[model samples]
Structures are given as structure tokens and as C-alpha cells.
Target chain A: MKKEHFQENCYVSGHTACAGCGQSMAVRIVMNTAGKDTIASNATGCLEVFSSKAPESAFGVPWIHSLFENSAAVASGVETALVHQGKKEGINVIAQAGDGGTADIGLQALSGMLERGHDVLFVCYDNEAYMNTGIQRSGSTPFSASTTTSPSGKHSTGNPRPKKPMVEICAAHHIPYSATSSIANPKDIEIKVKKALKIKGPKYLQIHVPCPLGWRSDPSQSIDVAKKAVETGLYPIVEYEYGKLTKSRKISSPKPVSEYLKLQGRFRHLLKDAKALAEVQQVADKNIEYYGLK
Target chain B: MAQAAKLCRPGVIAAYPITPQTHIVENLSQFIADGELDAKSVNVESEHSAASCVLGSQAAGVRSFTCSSSQGLILMSEVLFCIAGMRLPVMLVCANRALSAPINIWNDQQDSIAVRDAGWIQLYAENNQEAVDLIIASHKIAEDPKVMLPAMVCVDGFILTHGMEVVDIPEQKDVDEFLPPYNPPYKLDPKNPMSFGLLGTPDVYLETRYAIQKTLGDVLKMIPTVGKEYQDKFGRDSLRLIEEYKTDDAETILIAMGSVCGTIKDVVDSQRKQGKKVGLLKIVSYRPFPKQAIKKALDSAKNIGVIDKDISLGSDGALYSEVKSVISSDKKISGFIAGLGGRDIKAKTVEEIINLSEKEENSCRFIDLNKNILWEEFKTI
Candidate 1:
């Protein structure tokens, strides 16, 4: 089961996370690819909660965890300080946060960092909902997905809004680099981090990590669920340079949207509602058209 | 304050534009642009980012600075607590101003007072000289090996920030000897890897707070030595937590902080000529509360009055509450809230405050208030 690409795993041992947590894997790949010369500012979330439990840390790299809303802003500070020491060239600064931190509370700071062109890489681990806060609906949550706060009932169809265009939002800032990545594609995760580290200005890479706890999916099926999300054309693995879409991972076997949704309990109610299921399929169809998925 | 920053030579300055606070950062930017200061300056998007920028740089072990006032201070309050809780020695200047809702942009201490327990060493400057001197001394006090907590020097918005004065600017070499380089014991280093400001479980969270509180107590003792050292080296008396102004043999004393102390002192001098037994006690450091010095300063006075430019809403002024807690005596100390939202506090107001305290029992008094206007609003409500 070993992938073609492997890293040194900057996110080390002695931590608490679900056995098959895809987000933790993404953290490992991103940081390892960022290398030993990286200093990180992490936001408060499951990553922060599990990695640091007082007097013990899972981070093998030099890291700092500030409030959830200021991780990117703090990274901007770290970058400027490196500039002061004439060490910006030698060190790489990275910001790590969950979907809630990136798309909602931390968005302003992220936009500011990108607009100001601080030489730092911002990595948003998009696990759909605020999984750490008991599966509350976040801006990045997919449409009709059942989160604790957005539960399906007689009057409700879970989240009414579609998934936030996080990568597009980063591109809108006209940053030097922006891309979509996932743990399912470990090669892409490492490749994007390597590419971002080489860029001289603000760059963003958002990895669509599947949360087994929030998704109510089988823990062992995390990789399958992540792979199915891409194969179904629901989550595009695309890259943008300076706001222009330059590259996208071609989907050769575009599975029906049901292949992805049927695996997770969050979307189980959609099976009974044909109209809602069609709405979800239409979203995947549009992504397939836009991304030119085969 | 900007000149003091220039002398201290922080590695980075992160600032956002806020009224009364804008000029300090503007000048820092101008210095960096003019090739006068070698530090990297960031005109951040908001006070929150400005504070985060400092947090980031300070974690990297490079000294940094930021400034804000009123709404800007409130915006930065979240990160203010983060900087202290993280145990980083960052410097922030609070150009003290009144909070909004009425949208006033005048001098008041409400903004800084609101974040009193944010774990920062809060110092108030009475005039331009103290503003300049305290800003210079802040780096030393905050960067003390024992006390790595951040410190904020609050200069009244418009009063010290806009009001010009002749300040004795210290030489760069002297400040260098005084502050040296900010070589923190621990820093964000790639080689010697470590995590900072990590999550504290309930097991260790209380101890972290206890450590900061104990370090703050250590600051009260260490800060005076820093001021004394500044005096010995530069021939200027600095670093006093509180300054006593003619309190000896006085029947009543007026205690205050920030620029209003100057007006109180002027009133005290004139009242002395009229054979009035009145004195002034100025609080230079508000965070540590300086209980010992406050007690010693107001010992001889039979009656006490506290002038606060900031209040704690339902309760009286914050200073009034703390002063009352420290001095557990039968002597009544009247609290007056005045000069709010940048309203003027003339010498006559100081005289009236002293006069009222001598005649009345302890209570919260509003100075220079238009009662008719307030009553009109009440009728409309």
C-alpha cells in the first residue's frame, strides 16, 4: 500500500488522533515536504488539540499555536521577522488551519497576508465541518451534508449552502500560487508543498481531508472516501497560478455522485429524496464540465 | 514614542491605522522608508493582524512593536491576551482613547482599562516626557530574563500622541547598553526544534496562569530597578511605578494617571498658595496596582479623591475600585469620572473634585456633566 512518494514525516509520534485520520496524514506530508527549515504557525483545531496536550508535542519541527483566527496573520509576522534577520531565504514559513479557521474566522487575515505578498505558504486542511467543535457546520461544508448543527429532518436538508470555493477565494486574491490537494493523492500533496515553497510570494494549498468522525463513515474507508470524492468529480484537484487555472488532475473514471455519498452516513437521507439527490448530482456534473473530467 | 522605538531598534514593526495611533506607525513607516530605521515595517490590514504579526515575529525571537487605540485596541484585545499567554515580550503602545457607540475620538483610558487582566504590564504616561521615557524603558522591563511577559505603555490619545513637547532623546549607544540585543532564551529555531504556546490541558493550564501572575508580581520589583538603571546611566529619573507630588502634610490628595495628573498638579500648586492643604499622587504603573506605593503616598491625607478617565460601567472607575481594595480604611475616597470621549478637564474641574471629596461621603461623581441634556434624553426614552 506504500505510495510512490513518502516524506520524513515532520508531524511525528506521541499524538492523539483517530486511527485513520486523513487530516493528520495531510499535515504530515505537507510539513515533511516543507522540510526541516520550516517554522509553522498552527490554528486551534483538531490538529492543535491532538498534537499538543501540554508538556508534550507531536511536532518534530519548530511550531507555534496561536488562536484559531490569527494563524495566517501570525505566519505573516514570522515571515517578516525572517526578513528582518535576512533569513527569509533560508527558512520557509507555513500556516496550518482547519476549514473553519480558513474560510470563516481566519479569512480576513489570510486575505491580508496574500494581498501583502508575504513569502509564506498557507495550508488549509478542509475537513468540511468544524469537526473539533462537535461537527458544527462551517463555510467549507458541502451542500446537504448532515453536520450536528445542520442535521437532516422533516424541515431540513442539512447544509443548504454549497461548499465554499476556498481555492477560488485564494486565487481571487491573485496570489502567486493556489492549488487543491488531498491525502488520497499523497504525490499531489508533496508536489504542491514543494511548488509553494519555491514561490516567492503568498501561496495557498487547501487539502480536502475527509473526517471520519464528522462524516460518520467507516474509519478504515477514509482513503476510499477521499479517492471517491475526486473520482466522482465532486472535489477537483486543480492548480491555479496567478488566478488562472493552469493544471487539473484528469478524472478518467468519473463515478456517479452516489458512489461518494453512499459511503458516508451524513448523506444517507438524500437517498430517499430523489430531487435532493439530483441537486447533488448536478453539482458534480458542473464540476465535471468545468474541470473537464472525463 | 516613535523616537524611543527608533532608539530601541526593534527588528519589526506591525501596525494598522487607528485614530490617535496612526501617527506613531506612520512615523515608523516614514523612518523605514527614509532609511533612518533599519527595521522591517508592515502596514497590516487590521489591529488583529498587527498584533498577530508581532506574535509571529516575537515567536521567532525577534523583537517587534505594534500600537492601537479605542476600537483598534479592542480589536487587538484577543491577540493581546495571546501574546501574554504565549509568554512573549512584545511591546505595544495603547494611544488611550474613549470607546465608541457615541463614536467619540477623544482622550480616555477606557480601551486599555477594558483589557486590564489581559496579562500585559500596563503603564500610563502622565505627559510627553513620561510617554517617551516609559516607551524606552518598556523594552527593558518586558524583555527582562525573569519577566518575559509583554508590556504596554499607554499614552492618552491626542494629549500625548498629538500634543508636542521637548523630550530628552537618549542616544542609540546608551539605549543599546541599556537594552542590549533581545536574545530570548527560547525561540523558533529550525535546528533546536520545540513547540511554543501549545495547548495546555486542565492539568497544566492553571499553572501557566499562576506562572504569569507570579512573573507580574516580579515585574513590580524589577521595573523599578530598570528605571533606576536608566537614571544612573542617563542622568534622567525614570522607571518609577508611582510619583508623589507634594503629598506631605496635606489634608486631601488627588490621585490620577495619564496627562490629567499635570492639571491636578497645577491645581495643587495654586491651592497651596491659597493656604489649602492639598497634594497630588500620580500612578505611573496601573497594571501592578502598586498597592504599597499608593498606601505610602496617601498616608498623610485625611481625604482622598481619584480622577478616572475610564469607568467599568455599572461599577465605578476601575482605578477607584482597585484603590478602594488596596486602602481598607475608614477614610472616604471619592471617585470622579471625567474627560470622557476627549472632553476637557480644566484646572477648575480638579479644584471642584477636591472640594467635593472633602465635603461629601465616598461615591461615584460625574464631572462637567450636562444634567439637563441627560434628563431630556430620559424623557424621550
Candidate 2:
């Protein structure tokens, strides 16, 4: 009923997440904003694993987990059921998955849900890699970020592929709402969720949650690292409504991507290579131009 | 079957186009479009999403339905296990078809049989009438308080899906009287919230699995009760776990499932006229396998032949293996692989198996398979 009630009544405490789990924090903000009248279909990921480990659960709201790739489909089902029971009046349906679940295994399902115009909010807690599966590289992993699957070895660098453009993909579906947020600004997450919830159709919110364990960032500076990601114009906080860009979190005092890269060990190797650092800087410059973050 | 679904009043129907299963969904879609069935029809892109959508709907405390076959079933295989594991009771109709590789789109038991281990209660149909009956019965069994497990009502691909037979589709009013409204034991309600389908560690993973297995074991007893209730309401008696025919003084019996059983029955009646003392045992329930019923049905037989439309590659037939394990008789029951890839199981094939069961020293036999054609490739390999 109230904004604070979401935090108090939705996702509760008591689980075994790592010290700096941005997925948990971003998810808490997302679920809390979703309020008490919400049912979540979660994909297999850090949030799914940490929040509700059998016999004990941190969730105060009703939640379910299907496969990693089918959360949107499952949520579509839940939404239909709610409407059938005439309970969709106040109930909010949310599907949450990690980066890999979203940009890779779950993309088709997400696209299907959006195209069907189902009233559900899909949240992708972008931790960059598969942290729940022991830090494997995922589709959401940034280029040159080290992961177990994409090691920065003598002969090779880390991931060579750029992070999949998930927000653009959501917009391509011509859905009612799509947004990018950062856990550093929990208010932004809360604002986007409130805005998206009121619009009745498929909505996507990709929150840049800095995973300290996966990214090799400082546990205490997880929020700070996330802030730097947005401040550097690399992870732009923007919103779109029905395919038109509506809002962009301005980069008034723009910093280099080096500042963001320095905070995480995943990009630690990039610091020494000027060519890699310039490549990462070019990514930031492109985002600034494309999103008008400047 | 579509009428049965309409009667049950499924809240959501996920329709994905696939062979054999397409006609069933098309009928439902037409019904919904005409306002005959008040249900949300989600035209999902794939079978995987179809399964997931139903799983979500059931988890959200409403009844839902979906159907598929062959490659579609294989596509849905992943979500099938998830629904069962999460204990969300779903009613899935699998029009069984053969797997591709010759890319054949025809009848066989391979589709549903392939997912036997996915933790759904599988019911085989002998005809279109039986298929319709099992649809309503499966919903009852799946929603039973004691048996909160998913169920699959399987009809042979084209044999029953394409074949039109007279079925007394239950009236909406009567069905409403029979089946209670969807009030899930645990639902995603904000008023009374609870977490579901959590990550299970090694300490509790096996325990969660054992819980489902225990519930499946519990289904063994509840199926007959539910079957009896469905019979009482619908006035159909043979929807029982197994359909037994003239095994009283039989020396040899033939065991099979789905529409092929109809042909087997015709053969058994003729064999009885010759005073051959042969019978047919049609297994209706495959999962929570009716072991006691199976043993009781063929208890008097001196020899038994298990007919399977789907082979398990290097092993024998899927049902044949299960039947052999539970028979309590000597491992002497012969396994016959027949009617694969939509190949018709003529009365002659049934007669051949009956004769083979009598004389053969228990072994696997590929009935009607041309050895010269099949073995030619084997010779090269």
C-alpha cells in the first residue's frame, strides 16, 4: 500500500548472498517497489538462489522459480491466471533474471512476452556475468571483463564481445515501457518501477547492479562502483516509452571509463593496456552521443 | 478434448503450432474467438513458452492447459520437469508422435514416452473417446489435494488426433458441478504470500525431490478414486488404470497402450474364437505405474508380450521395460517393437506377437520391420 511497506513486506531478510550482492540490492528495490500485491517468477540466478534456498526464504511475498530462460513466459501465465480469477485488479506480476538469463537464454521469451503486450515488468539485474554459476561469462558481460569462462590469460584477453543491448531489444518489441537504472540510485529504480507499473503492458528495467564478487570490485564500494559506471557514461540510466527515449540521466561532470574500470578487477588488466583502455573509453563516448548523456 | 477443456474452464490456454497437437488448439481458439469458451488464449511462439505459461498460470492459482507433440514435446521437456518439481499441477495433453531424424511427422509413442521421467502422471488413450475422458479425469487427478502433481493425457499422434470418433463431451453445467473452482493450496497472493521453487542445496535438494516422489507415490492410491469419480459422473467405466480383456483362462496375453489397443482387442476376440485362449491388457496409467494392477491383470497368463510403438534405442521399448520390471513373473515376457513412425499396427501384427509370445524364448522382436531394409545400414556400419 505504501512505498516503505514494499521494502518491509516484500523481500525479507535471512539468506546466504555474498557481502556485496548488487543483484540482491537492486532486486530488493525492484521487489519492494513492486509492493505486497506482486507475484514474481524468477529465473535461475543469484537472486533466485540467495533469496529462497529451500526450507528457508528471504521473500515475504509469494514467488516462484521456473527455468532460467522462461521467466517471462511463466509470468505471462501468472498474469493470465490473475486476470482469469479477476485478481489482476491490484496484483503486479514481475519476472526477474540475471544478465545471462536476460540477454541470452531468456531473450526469446522476453521478446514474446513484450510482443503479446502482457502486463508484467521484467527486471534484469545486470551483474555482467553468471555469478551464481561460479562467475562464467554471460551475454551481459562487458568486453574485456574477466570471468571464469573468459579468463585474461597470457595468450588471450577476457570477453571480446560487448554487452548485449537489452534496453534497445526491449524497445524493439514496441512495448509500453523500457528503462535502464543503477542500484547506486535506488530512487531511480523506485521511480522507474512506479512509472512502469502504472503502464499496462510488458515493461523492462535493466538495473546495473555491480557484483563485487563477479566483477572483483570492493564489497564496500559496490554502490560507489555502480555510480561510477553511470557517471562515466558507460552504463547510461535512461528510459523509453513506446519506442521513444523519454529520459536520460545527464552526465554533468563526466568521468573517464577508467574510473569505473579501476574499481573492478574484471577490468584490472585493461588498465595496463592503453589500447584496451581507449577501446573502453570509445564505448563510453558512443553511449554519451547515442543517449545525449552529455 | 477441446470441449472437455471448455467445460473445465481453463483460465489460460497457451497455443503453439505443432503437428497432431495443432487441431486440438485450433478448436479451442475458434471456440474462444466465438465467445463459446471464456479463456485467455496466448498464442505463444514455441512449445517451451507454452509449457512455461501454463506453469505460471497454475502457480498463480488458476487452472491452465496446453498441448504439444514430438519435437514440440521435446522442446517443452525442460519446463515439464520444472512444473512437476515446483509441484504446480498442470493439465497437458500430449498427442504422442515419433521423434524426427527422418523428420517424419506421424504417430508413435516416442514423444510422451521420451518424457516419462519428467515427473508427470502419464495416461495412454485407446481411442478418441478415451482421450476426451482422460482429459477431464486428468484434471481431477492433478488437482487432487493428495496428488498435487502434473498429468499428461496422451493420445497417439494421428491415430487419435486425426481420427474422429464419437465422444460425449461433458456439459458445462455438469462439469462445473464435478470440478471445483481453482483454489490453489499455495498461490501467489499478496494477502497471504509465500516463496516457491527455491534453490535447493545438496542438504535439501534430495529432500525436495523425495517430497515430489512421495506425492507421486501418493498419486498411486488417489488415481483409482479419482478415476472412479470421473466414471460416476461421466458414465464411462473403462477409464480405469488398466483395461483387461478375457484373461480369465488365457494362456498368452498381449499388452499395449493408446489406440493400438483397439486393434489388439479386435485380434484378441478373433483369437478367442479359434479357442486360442489369448487376451489383451491395455495399460492406461503409465507413470506411478500401475504395477499391482498390471500383475493382477496378467496373473493367469502363461506367456506375455509387451507391444511398444517407441524403441529406447539400444534398449527395448519404454513401456515394455517398465512392464517387464513390475510383472513379478520371470523375465520371460517378450518385448515387441511395432507401429513406429506411424506405421499401422494391423491385426496381423498383433497376431504375430501373440504367436511369438507362445513359442519364442523371451526376446525383443521388431514386428513388421523389414530386416533387409533396416539391417542394410547396420551392415555398412
Candidate 3:
């Protein structure tokens, strides 16, 4: 631990993740916090495709990518194997996936992993939609946001459903720890990841990672978009321990949902429809009241 | 099967319950509960997780195991290919059962045959004793550094899985000596960091598959050597690729796999007792298909009757087509599809198939079909 020696990045710069990619930033922070003694089981998504392409891998730690919906199960196996080998003392196992891989297809395996009480951290990088598949609607896609599958038209206002309560669902599993953070707050993400890795059971950390390509926003504003989401009370940064809320980030002065929506093209149609705009505002208002974000 | 797996001393066992595969995992659970075996047995949520769990454990350098039945095998099919492509030496027991539309849970070979091309070594057992022997031998065979691939020991559901006989479970000390602890060449270790299951671009993806294909061909030679070594140690000759029963001097030979081979052997014995030139050629290794051994076994036969418990739907029996591909063009081979959806392939059915192969050269004949019900159903089509 010499002060002069710079800490080498676990996630290096050569990865093909797009510029200002919120998921890449979140992954870099998480990996750096977990450090070199970590093993990561990644689900098939943007992170896996961009980081581990043939002949070149961006990971500085032991990394494995299985199918789309089994990272939790695979991490459980990795933890069990390490325990079996008497090597579980200092190592950390982390399972990571996108929103679709977590809230939708991967939910069953994640539930199983948590129920089994494996000592691993499961991270869901919430990018809103299936950004790797060119922006399709997912369970985590917000209400009134237009994607390729859920397009806004005269008859419809994009995705009819609100974002899935993923952190609440994970908290319902009665795990040791579960939390929501954002790429805009890498310090919080780093602290939560470090804390979760120290607990003795499954922990969930869902990070709000805005995709510039999918959101049709400027790449430079990716962190700004994520910050606006938290400031508007739409994506409340919160934490739960043993199915009970322990903490939440308060919005000192809550901004209008329009400020967050106006930055991204996916929500452009909502501005044209007053009813849809109000509905979107209602989602943020409800979150603000429920989690006491304001 | 559970005793054999326990003897192999797998560091991890993960499985989900489905039909006849349940008993195998249940027994393993009991062993773990009783402290008879020191292992981590994970009861996963589904067959897909069961397979993936073992894949993760095996990739982390522990010998892992899982078992499933028809639908469960199909559910685990994707991960089966992944485990093979990643070159993990995991062992699985496939209690073969019929697939559902009608939803029958009885014994059938259709399930294991369905995943023949998933790159796992597929071994079919004719009885419980052979099932036990194969489970133990598969660990050694699959764990060889030269042939590091996942293996499936396919035991017929309810037939070998549920049926009990006096099986000589090997001593744990002997099994340990026979099959040493699995030492993987590469693993998920922080001490020596490595990335596995990476996206193989066009430049490397094709060669990775080619390596597996080439290794499987090498496995065809290595199985007999391992089988002979096992026989030398255990005094049972049950792990050969194909078993020849009086095929040398027979005019007609019947080929089959799994527990149905027991019935074929019984019919073959009676036919030989009556001075008939009939024999049995049981397929033990179904995946590398045993083409050369099959070609050698059927060299002198005038007629070959392949009693397949599964079919290729539009074409013919899978085994019959494979057998036909290896043999000379002059050989008369008839495929008899029977015991589908767990319809009993009785001794009478085997006799009928033998008689039919002599007079006709039918490719996909459904034996023991109730013609009245079939024609009644066929009228609508």
C-alpha cells in the first residue's frame, strides 16, 4: 500500500463500451472497490460483450460470463466451490447483469441464490431497457418511455407500465442487504459494494446506469441524466437491510420530472401529451412520498 | 447412481427434482445429511440453474455433479453445451423419460437422444448395475486432461432409476485411488486470474468447436482404454462403447440402447436357443456414436434391426440412421420405432421387430401399434 504507486484500474480503458457509458462507469467503480481478490460472474449483456471479447479482456480479476439469466446461480456455485476448497476467507464473488437479465429473465435464479443464503453480491446495472439489443422495452423500462418494442404512437404513450420495483423485490427476499445507487454517485456505489461484500449472505445492489445510445442523449450528459433522475425523485437512492429500509438519499430541492425527461429523447413524446406527462410526474411523486426521498 | 456419485467424491452436487431424476438427488441429499459424504449439495430452483450451478463449480476447479430427467435434460440443454465448450469435466445423470405434450413420465430414450449433439459424452446403461458403473467411470473418463468434457450417464427412467438390484457399490478408498481428485487445467482463481466463456469472435470460435470435435474423436479411442482399466480394477466390463453379444456368427443383429437392451438380450437368447442366427449389439456410448465399432459388429450380418426408443420425427430412428451411415451400402437395415412415450417394448415387440427385419426393409416402422386406434386417428389427418 504505497502512496506513490497508483492503483491500477481493474476495468481498463481499452473496452469497447460507448463513451460516457453509465454501466461502464458503475462497473469500474464496483470492480475497483471489490479489488483484486474478486471473482465476477457476468450475465450475457453489454458489459460481458464489451469487456470479454476474444483475445482481449478488460478484467484484471478472475471473470466468467455464462448465459443471460444464470449469473446469480453461477456465483452461488463459485462461492460454494471456494468454500469447498477452503479458499473462501479473503475472496469475494460478485454476480452482475443488466436490468432485463435481472428483473425479468434472471429473477428466478436470483431468488434462488438469495434464498439459499450464498455469500455473494448480486449487482444489477439498471440501464432502463435492453440497450445491448438496440433499445427494447424491459421490465425496468420506465412508464411513457419509447423504445423499439414499446413505441409512442397516436394510440399509445410508449411503455404503459412503470419501472419494476426491483430493489423492493430483492429486499422481499429477506436477504442480508439490498440497495439502490446510481453511477452519478460512484462514491456511494463503492461504499455499498464494499459493505455488501463483507456481509455473510446474498446482497443486492441495483445501480441506475443511463445509456446514452438508448436514451438518445448526448454522451457527455450520461452522468447528468443519471443525476437528474435522482434529483427528480424518480430513481430514489435507497438501502434495505433484512427487508427493512435503512437509508435513502434525500432530494434537498426536488426538480420537476420534466427536467429529467427533457434531456432524453425516449421521453420526448410525453411532453407532447399532457396526460402522459402528468402520469410520469405522478410516478416520481409517488416514489418521493413512499421512500421519503424529499 | 447416487452411491456411484458419492464414491466419486464430487466436491459439489447441484440438482433440481423432476420425475425419476428426483430419487438420485434425494439419495445424494440423504448421504450429505447423514455425513456419509462431505459435499455441498445445492437444491437449485430449476434444471437450468442446476446445470449452470455445476458449470460454475466445475469451472472453479471442483468436481461437480447434477442429475435430471426428460424435460429437465431439455431445460439443461443450453448449459450442457456451455459446460462442454468451456471444457469443464462435470458429471450428470440423465434419467431418461418421455417429453411432454401428452406429459408422460415413464422411461424413454428420447430425452437423452435429444441432446446428443450438445458435446457431452452420452452413455446409456442397460441396467442399474451398469448405471452405477458408468457414473463412476464417467468421472474418470471426463476428467482426463486430454478429454476434459462434461459427461451424461443416461439411465432409463423408472427402469434403471427406480428399479433396484444387488449392486456392488465400490469402496470410497478404491474409488479415490481409481479416480483421483479433479485437477482442472484452468479455473476461476484470483491467485491466477483468467477469463472464461469469453465471446469467441469468428477468428477463434470455429477452432474452439473444432478442438472439441477433434477431442471427441480422440475420446473414441480413450474410452476403451479407460473401460479396460476399470474392468481390471472392478471386475466388471460395462463401460465399452458397444457390446457385441453373439454378433460374430449371426445372420440378423438387433441394435438398441438403454434399458430396452435387456429385453432385446432376452429375445436374442431365446432365438439362439431355437437354433436361430440372431444376436444383440448394445450401444453403450451414443454420442461419438461408435460408428467404427458398429460397423465392425454388423460386418457379417445380413439384416440389421435397430430398435429405437426415439425417432427423428420426419425421417427415421436416430440410431438407425447413424448405424446406416457407418455400415456398407449392401447391408439391409430396418429401423423399428417402439416404446415411444413409455409404451412398453415387450419381448413380443422385440420378436416382431426381428421377424419384420427379415422380410421387409422398412425405415421407420412403429412396432406394437394398435392399428385400429391408429387408423381411427389417421382418418382425420
Q: Relative to the true structure, how large is the alpha-carbon lDDT of every model?
A: 0.89, 0.86, 0.91
Task: Judging by lDDT against the true structure, name the best candidate.
Answer: 3
Candidates 1 and 2 compared: the better one by TM-score is: 1
Candidate 2 residues lying further than 4 Å off, grouped into runs, are A1-7, B328-331, B375-381
Q: Clash pairs of candidate 3?
A: none
Off by over 4 Å in 1: A1-8, B376-381
Provide the clashing-pair count of each candidate structure. 0, 0, 0
Candidates ranked by DockQ, best first?
1, 3, 2
What TM-score would each prediction reach against the true structure?
A: 0.97, 0.96, 0.98
Weakest lDDT window of 10 consecutive positions for candidate 3 chain B? B372-381
lDDT of 2 by residue, A37-101 (tens): 88888998888877777777777678889789999999999999888778887888999898889
Every candidate's fraction of true contacts kept comes to 0.90, 0.93, 0.79
Model 1, residue B82: distance off in Å is 0.9
lDDT of 1 by residue, B45-106 (tens): 89999999999999898999999999998999999998999889999999999998889888
Q: Docking quality tier of candidate 2?
A: high
